[model samples]
Target: MPSGRTSARRFRNHVAAMVLAVAATLVSGAPAPVAATGQVAPPATAPSPAPVYPITARIVARYPHDPGAFTEGLLWHDGALFESIGLEGRSEVRHVRLEDGQVLARAVLPADQFGEGLALWENSLVSLTWKTGLAHRWDAKTLKRTGSFRYTGEGWGLASDGKALIQSDGSATLRFRDPKSFAVQRELTVTANGRPVRNLNELEVIDGAIFANVWHRNYLVRIDPANGAVTGLMDLSALATEVAATDPEAVPNGIAWDPAKRRLFVTGKLWPTLFEIALDPAP
Candidate 1:
């Protein structure tokens, strides 16, 4: 099998060229809103010398997790954890017990599709497939295969703002889509302080803020969906150090918020444990 990284790198290079071309063509418009409409352009403000940190995470609790599963998407729905695990031949959608990371129900994807991000809207669990140009919807309760949708580009992460589905394609842009129609409502470019933040993966929406993992980075960025500005940054270098002995593919990738319990959780691809964390001031 060809390396996913090789293909991914090629796609990124292509997207980069496309973005540069688009940026050069646009004469003038709102800078901050360029991402909002999926149009690449430079921001009005000049680039900052360094990225700013506005928020962070502090461990609150820790729970055991299966070290073998390569988790890609994670979210809290009702009383269980809804997860999507990747790898084309090993992809699956699982309903897990939050108390002990136990799988209560699961559905296997076709051996050809690698699962990516997941978003729960009302009764449907929308799961994206990496580079497959398809998304599967399942019955959240029964785990039955419900339907599928078509999308262009790579699917990296997914979340819901309680109103629309937010999707990341390993790009700086996050697209808002109608859950029912899968029509793009709007797109936003995420920027940290002043620079475009790309390689966004595994999205989680909490308190109206969009939290995304900056691929290959050690932190999760808090983004303003309205203007694509990064409001906060939380570094996870400590957690990465703890799991340094694990697989190289194991990186921070999962995020879920228990709004009812007011709890936030994060974990990596093949990590042995999932942690509930509290945000702290970065110093």
Candidate 2:
């Protein structure tokens, strides 16, 4: 019923509208086959990132620690603490008294070797050397050098989960090895907020979870051993600041957990004090 000119104008308008819609879609790069109602649905929302719960350290007690020792690894066994002190020429392993921080026994490493993480496997105590790819075994009771084994990379932190020996090579990946052969059994990549977490040092296995120190950082990350996801982060900024006040190089580096007492202790390289702490949910 419309006139020819009017019909032509309407057709042209329809073409123009279609072209505009296509242009808009192309410019936005949004997916569309226009909806049934001719409206584009919103783009799917991205999944939320995994949560990292913050943990606050509550000081339970404080014990004197050696300010001269560059502590790299620490662990508690029986009633005493075993520590590995680093620095190429000054590296040593010491059996320390918890009550007085007394060095009851000590074994100095080779001048060429820089000691790193320490862990106990059954009756033997195992220690790692930085850049040497060597791991040393000692009698847990006597601290006598029993033997040595070879590994592949730089050893930053080490811990034993009873069965396999877990080791970190300053990378995000943790390797689990056969206790006797030192052969790598499997590996787990540590992650925080969907990104790899590197510089993992001074490891301690607490209640089946791996607690690691990020090198030069003032916090400890609690990692899920099965999946390597960071479930909790314990901030030790105050403790680090306290130690750094006297010695700026005294960054946090040690973690020792007494399973029987359920007590957790932490210290730093060249720190004068070691703290017994309990983690509480951050406010």
Q: After superposition, how far is residue 79 of candidate 1 from its true place, in Å?
A: 1.1
What local lDDT score does residue 141 receive in model 1, on the 0 to 100 scale?
96
- Residue by residue across 1-283, what tens digits does model 2's lDDT show? 9998897567545433433442344345355233222323223111112455555457889999998989889999979999999887999999999888999999999999989999999998999998899999999999999999999878889999998999998778899999898999999988765667766889999888899986655678788999988776676777887776455456789999998988899999888999999755333
Largest lDDT belongs to which candidate?
2
TM-score of each: 0.80, 0.80
lDDT (tens digit, per residue) of candidate 1 on 1-283: 6597887566445433433333343323333333221433233322122444435455888887778788889999988799999887999999999789999999999999989999999999999998889999999999999899999988889999889999998777899999998889999988755567667889999888898886655567778788988766666767778767355567789999888977888888888888898754333
- After TM-score superposition, the amount by which residue 143's alpha carbon in candidate 1 deviates from its true location, in angstroms, is 0.6
Off by over 4 Å in 2: 1-50, 245-248, 280-283
Question: Which sections of candidate 1 miss by over 4 Å?
Answer: 1-51, 280-283
